[model samples]
Target: MPETLRKTFAKWHHWIGVFCASLLAIFCLTGGLCTIGPAFDHWVSPLPPSISKVFHTPSAESVAVATEYMEQTRGEAPAFLRLPTPQDPVFRLIRYDGNAFQTILSLHPETGLPFKDKPSLETGFFIALHSTLYLNRKVIDFIGLFVSLAGLGAVISGILIHWKRLKSDFQLLRLFSPTPRRALDFHLFCTLIALPFLLTALVTGVWIESQHLVEDFSPRPVISVTETESQKNLPAHLPPEAYKELYQAGAHYWGKDNQGFFLIAPHQALLVPSDGKSISLTRPHLALTQIGVKSWNIAPSTDKNISLTAFVKGLHLMRWATGEMRWVVSLSAVLLWAALGAGSFLLLMKQRSALNRRNACPSRSDKIAFSFAESFALSAFGLLPLTLLGLLWLEWLSPKIPLSLSIHAPQGRVDAFFCVWIGLSLIGLAFSLFRWVGSFPFADKALRLLWKITLKGSVFFALALPFITLLGREWRHLPLLPNTASLLLEGHFVLFGLILFMCIRKNT
Candidate 1:
């Protein structure tokens, strides 16, 4: 409350905000992508239309055939099999290292052989990036610690700095005002709007990451095996079709109302089932829904219900939330993204103005910093979205490209992503930042021309994505609802492109 202390908090807020702004933006951007979409990212997986066209009920024989194939060929034993469900309609052989799953293969319901065992655009890639940023556990834990602490600190300091204005500016907007006032108001409004979601996400994220850190460093406790030696050493042959068999038996008795999934482990296959009413996947956990286990050696597990860990994980990830809850979680992240973007823009503008004022003094470091910021702004604003659509375009086109084009089939889509991204980064930097900083009298004419072309051309390209995606043969298996969702997402992108088009200030 004191003026001096408030000023100190204000300074802390500004500097910390500066430090976290870009990374927070990136965090939100990737998080938003990971959570949302009318069309789920997993739908674009590399399943062949031939295999995907029809649903075939999986039988014991089918599982046996698939199991035989996997046991003979796989380097590691397949941990579990997923039965034919309406959603997937094929057997999935899954293996796990720790808590992480590696889907070994999808087997044909009829032939029981592996289908196209790879997906080009893996949805898991984004999730992995969000969690670990590809760093090892210990390293990422440290980063997570820093992010959480700094985020909390930023929020607290921001509250201190804007304690009075928070309430006063809650409903204020200068949308029709001059650019400077309008931009500031927009930034403030977004900050106020997004504060609750941002704080919740940070807190939840910190809790989840901290648990991992503690678990990683903590020593394991010793366990006493009280089971009879003969029972413990019981030689059990795990039928590859065990889950399918059990599920069939359960379904026969419980009827269509009960549904669930199996969790495959080295020694036991746990059946986590749910009745539609009392317990559904919307909030079901291992303890909550785990009815029993099909063990290789030990007796079937007794019924268990509910887990605190599962609840926390579900709440943070929104994996347990169904319907409108998912929308709230996703939209909140998006709003946070917009707020971060507005705040970052304001910071960059302030820095640029400061740099311009110091132009007479000739600060090389300031120029360099400003140049980096300028280039980042251009890439994030312009090239990022274009590259995303380019990825879609390339994915659709890659199947049409003959093998002679030298895009390796396995890595082709990934290659396309980087090619578009890096290519645009290079071209954009040359035309925009490098030229603007140079003494050339042409005065970045190349940038203006390039910008105009991109903005105008991209709207048409975005509008065409739904049709192109629909035309993909692999997508023929999509149900009517999923197809509709994909189209709705495409329309969203079209609107985004139109917004870009409207940003043109003058002719090149």
Candidate 2:
């Protein structure tokens, strides 16, 4: 390596790491948590009814059901019924009085009763916390953008630092090092090995968060459609059953045309002359035969909304790539946390050695302080996996619990799961503290082997996650054996842990 360039790059890497470590840590933790997002939805909602109980109606029928329910409950018709799709459990009915859009939910098929119960907080809570730390939204967005950019810098600098040793250090973890060197090795190994996932995550993170910028720059047309006498004379808000009426009208308008989904916005005119279709708040799921209304003639018939771009984006982010993929990401995150802790410890040990040499005999307080810091890091590293495992165990146990009569969803099992998981996390965290009690050193040989094995296992599981989902014949349906794939990977984890135990058994 050239002296000047090497020195310059080293300086940059060092400073950047120092500056961004805290933020990097937060991003790492959040990204890791998001690995379980897909599974979260399963817990958030009531267990779906038996497949046989679910009614598969034409899109038009969905509209009719929504409208009928609205008329009975609200005593007025809604100008809009956002089309029903498989994704949302409830259909949204919209009324545009003179000023604003009011929304109500039709609880069941042909039951326009407004959802009297409190809405589930899970969806909103995750979204709010994920984007902002529940702080100001704009500030959080800016901070997210900053974190993403910093991640970019860290990755670039990190790669440079490990450029030469990159291949050789792929399996790097010194067996018998003081803390600092060990920590460096651990850090290098993690960054070097998990580079691709981290990079993709970082880039995608920034892009996803910056969507508002595109909206700001894009051009939108002004809506200018003359309402028909019937539309003008129509009450400011249509009856609650407007959706059902619209759907029935549309069903008759387009015979046997079973478009999916609906959207209702009554305040806006039902036509956009600039675009070919009328102003429809709803759309169809069918790719080839999807219809978008450019205009709605209130005098003649009802209209179904159409637009293609929205679904494509929704599919990408939801990542319903199957349960196995979720498991892979979750496991990778677990490994990443381990790597971080292990590597950081190695680095700290190296530093401690230097301190010891400089002082010849360091004071007791300094040692205690150093020990406390190490314990904190290790706590973070250990707590995450324990928490995750607890959650999984909860999911496994949830089916046995009874349901809530007042709530639309099953409540007992999920509640129990959280309580037990959180409790176990606290307990496991206390137990893991034993690892930090000693200034003792372990033989590096087994630790080294363990790291390699875990790394390989993580990669194997990650690749396996997506492929298994894709290969399944009924990807959309529940797998007959939910436990099968996870159990195999878990067995691998147990075996890996056992192997590590044999390797480091004497050291502890």
**Whose TM-score is greatest here?**
1
TM-score of each: 0.70, 0.49
Weakest lDDT window of 10 consecutive positions for candidate 1: 280-289
Q: For candidate 1, write residues 230-276 as lDDT tens digits.
A: 22331243356553465555456444323344554333344444323
Query: Scored by CA lDDT, what does every candidate get?
Result: 0.56, 0.43
On lDDT, the leading prediction is: 1
Which runs of model 1 end up more than 4 angstroms from their true locations?
1-7, 36-38, 42-118, 159-163, 166-182, 185-196, 218-237, 248-268, 272-310, 358-384, 404-412, 415-464, 470-482, 495-508
How far out, in Å, is residue 398 in model 1? 2.5
